[model samples]
Target: MKEYIDLFNRLPNLIILEDEPLARYTGFRTGGPSTVLIPTEESSFVEAYRTIINNHIPFFVLGNGSNVLALDEGFDGVVLVTKRALNHISVDETTITSGSGISLSELCRVALNHDLTGLEFAYGIPGTIGGAVYMNAGAYGSEICNVLNKVVYLDENGNYREKNLSELDLSYRHSIFQAQKNWIILSASFSLEKGDHDTILGKMNELLNRRIEKQPLDYPSCGSTFKRPVGSYASKLIDECGLKGFSIGGAAVSEKHAGFVINKNKATTSDILELCHYVQHIVKDATGFDLELEIEFLK
Candidate 1:
């Protein structure tokens, strides 16, 4: 660990912090600390990432930290925060190119400003563009693959490469990035259409309102605890199994949305994990359908 820290410290213009708390960065708001690296420039980020990988040091690339639950014991390696160095947006007519670190909401705002449609479905998604593309994030019958044209990423050999939409192999909450662990998303190009500004804004607001009405927006939670099972909805199954409002330690199945397990009273990562497992077990036993988690767990 000392050697790893020393190697990271040698990278110029990179900000290294010891025992940095991760709760403040994640939506769950409950996690322990880890060694965090924040690069001030793209060159520094490339150097830091290469150095870590070449030295076989354990590391994870992080975006907005939305759809992940870091364990109580914390990550024992480096946390590379992409937002610190890779946030940039550019518009070329109806095409928009964005860095992976930029937030989905901010991207939507950019589209709205340029009268670009096709990104309205992402208006309220609380995640970075990288995570969105990696997960093929979607809402209201639309997904990121709808507008994505190409992606620039770091290959396994620390070489930068680009892939077009067809090669991405995108599907419901799955992408080629999930299968290739060493592929690090850097930026993406999206093809949109020109539309009326007022109409686009109205659609975005309508979707935001619907999300607020159906989701537990006020609570600290990874949105939608389980994936929508084929021919069934995970939330409906949990609700039917009488798991809504169920409590385990400081965690509870949200009364407003059975899909969410929220930190109602400073819940620990263990509490959330236990509660999610219990919900999955009960829902499966009752409905004969296995509930797959939508959020990733980091340990």
Candidate 2:
């Protein structure tokens, strides 16, 4: 691990920070330190990513870190950051191809700029294209699978490959990526329709306003805390269980939106995990519904 990290540091235009705090990269803002690699160039990023994958080095590919909760003790391996490095987006007629690092907000803006429609559901999301692809991010009765045409990714062997939309196994807040953790997303293309710019802008604004009005955006969170169980919504269930505004240490269920678990104060990783567990327990005892977490807890 040390040898490859040192080698990555020597790669031109690659920014390598040893023993860097995970809090600086993640939205939770409550984790210890690890070695983080921030790619400044595409070639360097690709080389480092391939090396880490092919050599079986312990590593995690992080996007905007809006959906991950790192452990308090932090990771012992490398964290590959792909925010500014793999940021590329292009339009080909009605198809839009974007690198995994591009923020969802920017992607929506680009779609609107091209007078394209179908991605407004993701307008207010703070995650990156990579995270959205991995989780099949959705909102307002729409999901990424509805428009995604294909995915270009690096297989477990660190070889570039492309897969059609049908092969991704996309579902509500789930994707094949969860089962194939070693497979790294590179880019994806979405099929959209030419629409009136004003119409697209209006749709985007509507969803953004909905998020702002209902969510506790002032605090750090991994968006919704739990997946909606069959025949019921997680937020509605928690609200029924009287778990909203419940707190453990600095972590609390959002009073504004029961679906979210926010870092209310200076929360610790333990605080967040414990609070989530408490909510799950209470909700299950009250309603008999199993509440599965939507956020990824990284150790």
Candidate 3:
């Protein structure tokens, strides 16, 4: 990674460090250390990409890490995490432009503040804007694709480009970025319609309350464990398989929400992986439908 060294040397705005524990920075609370941890800024993203490209080093762009499972051994390459910086948002009429590092909860709050009616479904959703766009994250039948107008992202060649919603191919929690690892989301524009401020806030709060009531918020989890299979729901299928509250070490299929694999207490990455394997095996054996994992497992 001489290119990485060269890039790092030129990019001063991004905070680059070494031997950082990823678990301490993620929502799942389990992951090994990383070789290099770089917190990037909008101005430095291009240069950082240049470093990665020039060095020919594999890199990971992470945001909140809410939907990923990092192994105990950790990652050997560079980890470009969007956390502290990238927190800008602007609204004009019904259009909202957001940085990739902004959290979904915060984004919902922004929308509510502006009396926007489109983002209520994202009120309690974890992860950042980049992750949401990559997954087309949705709840209550609303997705990022519903409001997204265009996306400004870094393509494979380290050049930034803007893509319209039509090019994203957004479907059930899947986008062009999900299928193509080379695309790195930088910012997005969402178009919402005006609504009553109080009504929007109330709706957001209502959805948040619903999430709290149904999901296991007491434990550390990456929300849903499996994707909703076509024509069926993963939670209902797992619950029907009689695998709720199942355990493997410190990890357990949430008693409250079967679709959520929770870290009961002192859970290890190994424990989480084991429980996921068990859930998939049992659910497949019972229903003959392979449970596709929604969580990205990384090492």
Candidate 4:
């Protein structure tokens, strides 16, 4: 680890932070510390990722950190932070290309500024374009799969290549990327339609307001705790089971929106996991719904 650490510090466009708190990066603000690597350019990012893979160094790629629950013990290896490293964007006519590090909100804003119509559904999603595309994230009947044209990613062999929408195998909170965690998303290109700038802005604002009104935006949460169960909504089931506002330590089911498991006060990672399992147990026992978490629990 020390040799690799030294090697990373000398790499171009790479910044290294030793013993950095994961809490500072995650939305939940709970995990412990680890060495973090931030790559400011695509080549440096690819090189760092390749070196870690070849050297068998454990690492996790992080984007906006909104859809993850990292353990309190934190990772022992490099935690690659892409929030700044991969935040690049460009537009050509009605097509847009963006680094996986750019936040969904930022991507949406870019689209709106260019009068693009198709990305409004993702305007307020908390994660980055990579995470959103990896999970096939959707809202208000629209999904990333709808507008995504192709993606550039580092394959298992550390070779970068382009993949089109159909080749990615996207479907409802799942993608080939989920199965192949080593497949690093570099950037994504989208095909969008031209629309009135005012109309796009209005739609983005409307969705953001809906999130504010219905979600516990004031609290720290991993967005929706559970995926929408077949033939039913997670929030409806949670509310029905009398679990709204149910607290376990500092973590609780959000009263504002039952779909969310929020850090109400100062919750630990353990507290959040416990509350999530409890909700699963109650929801399954009461309705046979077998609720599944939408967010990942990273340990």
Sequence-dependent TM-score of model 2: 0.97
Residue pairs with colliding backbones in model 1 are none
Per-residue CA lDDT of model 1 for 143-249, tens digit only, reads: 99999999999987788999999999999999999899778899999999999999999999999999999999899998998999999998899999998999999
Better of 2 and 4 by lDDT: 2
Give the per-residue lDDT of model 4 (tens digit) for 178-262: 9998899999999999999998999889988999899999999988989998899999999999999999999999999999999
Q: How accurate is candidate 4 locally (lDDT)?
A: 0.90
Among all windows of 10 consecutive residues in model 1, the one with the lowest summed lDDT is 1-10
Kindly report which residue stretches of model 3 are placed more than 4 angstroms away from their true locations once superposed: 1-10
Clashing pairs in 3: none
Select the stronger candidate by lDDT from 1 and 4: 1
Mark the 10 consecutive residues where model 4 has the least summed lDDT.
Answer: 1-10
- Per-residue lDDT for 79-177 in model 2, tens only? 998886889899999999999999999999999999999999999999999999999999999999999999999888878999999999999999999
